[model samples]
Target: MSDIDFVGLLSFVPAILRVTTPILLAALGVLISDRAGVLNIGVEGMMLSGAFVGVVASAATGSAAAGLIGAIIVGGLLGAVLAGAVHILKADLILSGIALNIAAAAGTTLLLFLMTGDKGMSGSLASQVLPKVTIPVIADIPLLGTLLSGHHILTYVAFLAVPGVGIFLTRTPLGLRLRAVGESPESAAIAGINVVRVQVMALIVSGAFVGTGGAFLSMGYVSWFSQDMSAGRGFIALAAEVMGHGSASGTMFASLLLGAAEAIAVALQGRGLPSELMQTVPYIVPVIALVVYARRRQRLLARA
Candidate 1:
């Protein structure tokens, strides 16, 4: 390719990473819960709530860090609520998750209306944006600088977390117990693992990761939270987790692919394409990827 063409293509890398950050973080969260056999279908709601909480807390305290912490705390509480619904109330897991999503959507809007007297957005609030990080030495490099430095802090955290999650799941004692419970709660119980406790912890951890993603949405991606700003990214994260087949590194790659699709759509919007059609690109890519993954899995099973 020509140098100009190559450079133009490379320009998209940063956008891809920026878009991928929240999806990757949330996908990792989904991976944790799924591994513990308690899929967090309410991850969408948790993310939406987190975004709202982050904005409100940041604006109220004049501290972005406080917003992030508040978001994480709220996400964990939502996860605990989900766990309670399943374990204590004996609610169907899937139904409970769906209910949470519905409640989060309505609840955030209601809270936003009460706070700023606006239900659709947080424009009245003076929320802080999380700062971007510029690696000192890396920032001086040519193409490497663009790819590796000067990203929102959460972007770095999300990427670094891939290996951290991988290690936790594969090398830790708690990881083993969580996996055992996921594989067979009955067997795990017989083996002396407290299935309920393990699942609860997994959901909390999952929600924490998800909350960070939500914080990114409001604090890093934009300085204000909009109604439904999550924009179905949480659902996309679920697809990424499924595409990842329960592996952190795989999920990261899947998130990048989906992020690239969204980035391309954004780019296309400037090229005079219908904005409505372009908006569907991100969602469409996941459907296609999932179909391919399902076919591949079926083929492997047949071969087996």
Candidate 2:
């Protein structure tokens, strides 16, 4: 920690924002599902599926928008399936999620091999990239503009989603019911809310958010999908949600904090540090942050 160069880190704000996009998006998904009383541990699988399908669809159609739509559709479908497994099939949510993640990892690799004869990546495909957005007046504001403007469109969407999610959960009727169901399914059911339906919907929405994050990985952050491209980001997003304690804004901030750590990890590469240790830094920071967050929560609760 003392070895980190503070001045150099300042220049990485944009990189932090860029990397934070997918994490924030995925964390939002986790937040919603958690709030709705359903935990979708298969978010990683959903993200991978979306990434693969998005790249494939965009390559075939020559449209990034189509790729995004494809990711969302696939993600939502997967979410619904997981929901069914937990709610209707009476499967353990954690075990079912683990199974889904394993299946998705293998299935996507197989599909990738079948399509491009390369299990590592879809380098052969010419996929369309999502456009970057530059705020008009904001772009001209010297230093501030440099930091604030010219991000991928999805970055804006991801940040905007923070508030949007908060509003949806706090101000909407469906949100209230979802929370009620999550808090006490029996009570919610007694009050005439279909607990199963709400859980299913929450999972679907969660999947959609994860899917969008996946799409950003393939289309916005990079131009192609690789096997296991999600690379534990789903888990990091989960951590962000846990650290945030299921608040949209808090989750967004947590994701950004992790993103900054990741950016520092990237920047520190090849700078006299052991390559393996530098690689581990990004993952290590989140664990530390989560521990700190947990400690803080415990203290607060003890005081209360």
Candidate 3:
């Protein structure tokens, strides 16, 4: 620990930003659905489906943009399907989401095998990678550019979404009704709001966000899709959402914390520390954050 270069570890800031992008986007999705009273437990499946479909579309069309569009469409459709299952068919949301996740995991693997003759990954596919953006003036700056420029376009989108989602949830009439529905569906319905419609719309929007994050994995984070590449990111995003109390900016902060921990684990590799333990750091941080959040909530409740 004493030998660890603190400044060198600080370089993990860039890595933290990169790793946090997917989680930030996904957590924003979770925040929307949660605020609307529909917790999307199938976010994992939604993300996996987007990743698989994004790679397939990119490889087929030879365009990363097309791949991203395809992912958003698929993700939105899945979101609608999830909502329909809960609202129309009266299925339990949690069970339906878990089913979708199971299906996505197996479905993606089977599709990968059919497409590339390899069930593990789409490495052989000629998928285009999403372009990275170098912020104009920021990129010209010395240290600032090094810290802030050259990230994938989706990373910038994820940060931009923080404000976008915040504004939507706070300033819009629809957002007001959505919150009303979440707080009390019966009251919202009596007040002339269509509870079902609001919940469904929130879920579809959440799906679009989750899909974008999924595409970031296959199209931007890397150039190919792999089996279960989401690697529990959907769950981590959920944890972030909980830690943030469903606020967009708050979720972003929690995601950054977790991302930084993961980045440090990566930076510390092979440095005489236990590699297995290091890999657990990212996961551990979320658990700790949740515990802290719960304690704070308890303290607030006690005071009240």
Off by over 4 Å in 1: none
Residue pairs in collision within model 1: none
Q: If scored against the real structure, what TM-score would every candidate get? A: 0.98, 0.95, 0.95
Which model is ahead, 1 or 2, in terms of lDDT?
1
Enumerate clash totals for all models, in the order shown.
Answer: 0, 0, 0
Prediction 3 global C-alpha lDDT: 0.90
Q: Candidate 3: deviation at residue 238, Å?
A: 0.2
Q: Write the per-residue lDDT of candidate 2 for residues 212-233, one digit (tens) a residue.
A: 9999999987899888999888
lDDT of residue 259 for candidate 2: 87
Candidate 3, residues 1-304, lDDT tens digits: the string is 3435755554566788989998998899999999999998989999998998898899989999999998998889999999999999999999999999999999999888887899876567656999999889998986678688988899999999999999999999998898899999999999999999999999999999999999999988788999999988898899999988778889999889877788788878778899999988888889988898899999999999
Estimate the lDDT of model 1.
0.94
Off by over 4 Å in 3: 1-10
Instruction: Write candidate 1's Cα lDDT for 204-284 as tens digits.
Output: 999989999999999999899888999999999999999998999999999999999999999999898899999999999
